[model samples]
Target: MSCYNHSNPSSFLLMGIPRLEATHFWIAFPFCAMYIVALLGNFTLLFVIMTEPKLHHHTSLDLLIYYFLCMLAGIDLVLTTSTMPKILRIFWFHSHEIVFKCCVVQMFFIRSLSAMESGVLLAMAFDLYVSICKPLRYTTILTNAIIAKIGLAVFMWGIGLMTPLTCTVSRLLFCGPRVISHSYCEHMAVVKLACGDITLNYVYGIMAANFVVGSDSIFIAISYILILRAVLSLSSRDEGLKSFSTCGSHVCVILVFYTPVLFSSYMQHWGQNIPTRIHILLADLYLLVPPMLNPIIYSMKTKQIRGQVLRPFYQKTEVRINFY
Candidate 1:
């Protein structure tokens, strides 16, 4: 009860990796490398996409794809940026304490941005479905105005899904030990430190996980199925290959993004018998892996992006953008 009357906000200690404290120095190197790669990859993708005339204005389909790629690259950048530095600090400097309020803020950004990323992937799936399965109506259905609304909806979808959870967490009485058993201010880890009944937190977290992940996974699967059917119906083998090539990057991104996420989320909730170190490792890897790989996946799969990447090596690459 007296904890509720404390003058200062609670400061929680972050354990970078539970059992690998001695190897923090060595571990920091690879994690740091991944962060650097993610930064360069995502930023280069953004710059090249923004400056590439073909991707920007070749066709309405190309334009819409560019817009989504921008959104995806931007999201990956923010998601990694929000949590990785602090994690590195924890690993290298042993800077582990985070204020309760700061923890809440971190929690908000990680949770919301993750959900937003999922929404964007779902949007991408829809875009692919329309492009492949309903090619003629694609232009009519996905104008710039419609794209803007989709972006807004993706942003709001994240907020709507996470706001309640964040608010509930903020209002909880965290009167117990402030030692969080993970690298960052992960929501369940923080919630585990709270004093009172956290049944609502548990239930809401499970439900939200189901609603966001389950539904999006289903829709994405359905979209891909429709896309596959449409592609297979094509009499030309080359056309089917091209269609698969178009979706290959997206499928890879989806797997990279969602596989670890689903594993970590459910394992954290249900895999109590599982070692804490495994969860911590996955959490750290999951944050960095998708961001680092997404751009590389796209670059390898998309010819235009690959050209822009190699362009500077061959010639003085010049890219221009206009502000109106």
Candidate 2:
């Protein structure tokens, strides 16, 4: 029996934004700024949801939506954190070396968190569908217990789907030239370095992407279709428009989250002539852009959240007005 040789390669050098080594310092600033915005926006949204009593006891449906939002915020944080810090280090300090085990761990977290974010978006879609279509039974249909169960299932689904991929990659023997061509340890990027056959890894990766992301997107589309149908059936045109508008923010978020992802996936397989720098930029945007924009989209579109966000400013304004 031939034992697997895990000691042949111990680390990997991440090539950040290929061919742009002379300007890594210039690139790091924007990336760092995006990271700060994502962190502050997500944390502020979470704080408003948790601390504001007005936000807490609004409606049963609102509460349910809040739960999903919390889950999403947490997932976005995990997803970005898994890659951005290491990416910053790579670009800023020229610290490109990452231990193999650490690389595997980062890849696992990034994939799993992205999958979980998809699940959370699906859950949010269901929430929107119920609130719009089955308004009468929204609370009964999605009770606290059911919401808890859904969150648990989404979490487990992500972990379960990514476990096999992580395990498979961990077992592979990596030879020399252990350099990853992207800013982070992406699954396929890491797998490409393996000395052994990667057929199983590729097969499993395709299956997982189809099963998790594809299925979630299909369900979200169906939910939105049903929601639109229900909204259009309303007697008052204005009311119908209002109901449809509620989903505008979610639709924007969905577009922002999935557009780059789909593009990146296509580029990965078919965009052979695409520049490596462009591919790496797309990959970074896939992780960073959604987290940075989701909170802003919601705050601007959702009156409830926006109200909470501006309450202090409004109060101070009123105080000044009264003093005058």
Count of clashing pairs, candidate 1:
0
Model 2 C-alpha RMSD to native: 2.1
Candidate 1 deviation (Cα RMSD): 5.1
Off by over 4 Å in 2: 1-5, 319-324
**For model 2, how does the per-residue alpha-carbon lDDT over 1-324 read when each residue is reduced to its tens digit?**
232345547789999989989998898999999999999999989999999888887889778877888888888888899899999998889999998878888988988888898898999999999888998998899999999999999999999989888888888878758889999998888888888899999889878877877899999999999988898789999989888788898899889988888788768767989998999888998888999999999889878889999989999999999999
Candidate 2 pairs with clashing backbones: none
lDDT of 1 by residue, 1-324 (tens): 221224334688999999999998899999999999999999999999987776765788877877888899999998898889999999889999887777877888898898999999999999999999999999999988999999999999998889889888877776667789999989899888878888999999889888889999999999999998999899999989999999999999999999999999999999999999989999999999999999999888888889889887656434332321
Superposition TM-score, candidate 1 onto the true structure = 0.94
Shift of residue 149 alpha carbon in model 1, Å: 0.8
